[model samples]
Target: MNKIKKIGIIGAGNMGEALISGFLKSKIFSPQDVYASEIIEKRRKYITDNYHIESFDDTKKLVERSDLIIISVKPHNVKDVLESIRDNITPEKILVSIAAGIKLDFIRKNLPEGIPIIRVMPNIACFVREGMIAICPSDNTPKEKLEAVKEVLSILGRTIILDEKYFDAVTGLVGSGPAYIYLIIEALSDAGVRLGLPRDIAITLSAQTILGAGKMVLEINEHPAKLKDMVVTPGGTTIEGLLEMERGRVRATIIDAVIKATERAKELSKA
Candidate 1:
């Protein structure tokens, strides 16, 4: 990451701008080290005004100037963006695609052979630097280059390296994971409100509880079941609630959610 100087993002939409935000928040890369290309003038202005990073409308120029280029455009727009910038990509430069369902081979076909490419699945939590990112690099990607990418990504949150085969699962688990958690939080908040808590207090308590539970699982170095046991005293109030949730099949439904989402991602990839 220290060796790589400029990071360019094409398509300064939500995810593209989020990457820029993450880069700046990381403190490893300053605004000067970031560049972007956005078709939308408003978004371009937003990037410069908010982050103080230079942005352009010319994709090729962005590629030519950047050390590592991230393709953050929509999946349907990937081919055109690649075609527009492919010639500018050199062997020493790294190209990363964060668009969901956009495969490495799909990106490779439009670029010169031996140009290293990386595919990443990152969630919305990236905006807050608490993201879960899954990275899969093309075979041509050098080991040292991959390490640099990992180092750069660490600021955003935890990263996992998996075979591209598991990316759809990653998408379901971590990429779309935040939305699932939000749904649970909402449900909990609503339950609190039903139990006579004020809306504002209910929401805050629900959110904090979720956040605290997640931190405990992560920081405690123990399995979640053991943690659950620590909370669920024998024949207590917690057990009664757990039994009710079990009766409602909540656990299986959550598992099915990820599975169903993964299947949908696989379908989208084929499309």
Candidate 2:
């Protein structure tokens, strides 16, 4: 519950590495204050050599030394990681998990009684420090501790505190959202290429257009429909493109994609 002086990450994958990178880049914690546990020798060596942080093959050792622990392993590996470090978890230490489909209750059941658990769902965008992260804390998590975690998460991107009940929806919307956006960008680039534009230029234009549109939504604080209306002059090219998109049921397809992904997330939680 005290200020986090030392942090340990349980995985060395992209998300784990991203957090480490963000933390160091933000100067919230120094490399010596951060530690990571990776099973692979090469990964451990790489993290230590590149980041100058302590790396270990033993999860228990990292848990023992860290004031806060972040579990960034895959969804299926969460329970095993919890079990391995269960005894090391104490009331004084806060635990955070970024694994999708893993719930706070599941983590609590795996750990010692009354251990504070925080569930986080961060998108792939976190790798670039432009992510949208959702955090859900267990009933036992102290307000101060949760705020401390939020401060650390802010370095990665925007952070929102939400009810655990909405996590599946968040998982679908933001967790899987990047892949959907990437697909849209790819399709737009392909369409440009088909229209005789250079492939590289098409990709750059497509990506930047999506980026600008997103920035407008965030900065203008207006409904996206209003923005679309502003772009559609009567009998214009934009309207023709909009009509084609409507004919293809693009909106419905995207909605279905999120729904289907949410359903799969629920299934994974049960598994």
Candidate 3:
């Protein structure tokens, strides 16, 4: 395995900060082993004071110094960032990007030929080390580099190595799925509060219920319909509630959201 001595993360936004936190908590890389570049002074100061990592305002300089470079900037600005560091990229360094809509080919063509590139899509849960991250390496990448990428991603939540063809769907189902669940949690908590439960208690119960239910599906490995049948008894309260959900078309709406989001992700790639 190749030793990743130093890692550079461009863009000090939420994703970048989350990656830094996971790296420290997992103890995979020390503060000195990480470097960050942020245009904002406040973000720069936060990383410097909190993690003690070297900070840079120049993206190209950061890429030159680190063995692994993570591009965490917005999709629209990915072109700009790649152009800035295109000349600095070398075959020895690995470039990993978390920007959606920026494909592996774009990164490969914009940078030096044969430079190792890994395109990833990770959610905000990574900050707490429970994130689901997708890793799709460029075809030119060697097995050794792919393994290294997997090791780093394991620090977050579950890491899956997938073909680039499924990236957009992955982005829809997992990447944007959190926000959908968050909305559901909030609505459930609000309903509890309307029934006279304390606000904090309602929120706590709602969150735990969702978490436990999610764990059940994963651990039991049963079809969701079978699980739903187990909960709905003949003329019981669960059946009554489920009937209301069916009447409201909740399932259909949720399914549509994932489909729409997946389509949008595909559209982004085109642009």
lDDT per residue (tens digit) for residues 1-271 in model 3? 5468788999988899989888888887889888999989998999899888899988877987898999999888888888988887898889999987779998887887889999999988888898999999998888898898788788888899988999998888888888999999999999999999998999999999998888889899999889889988898999889889999999999999999999999988999
Residue pairs with backbone overlap in model 1: none
Model 3 pairs whose backbones collide? none
Cα lDDT for residue 60, model 3?
Answer: 73
Against the reference, the lDDT scores of all candidates come to 0.89, 0.91, 0.89
Ranking by TM-score: 1, 3, 2
Name the lDDT value of residue 134 in candidate 1.
93
Root-mean-square deviation of every model = 1.5, 1.8, 1.6
Worst window of 10 by summed lDDT in candidate 3: 1-10
- Model 2, which residues run further than 4 Å from truth? none
Candidate 1 local lDDT, residue 140: 90
Residue pairs whose backbone atoms clash in candidate 2: none
Question: Where does candidate 3 stray beyond 4 Å?
Answer: none
Clash totals, every prediction: 0, 0, 0
Q: Count steric clashes of candidate 1.
A: 0
Model 1 stretches with alpha carbons more than 4 Å out? none
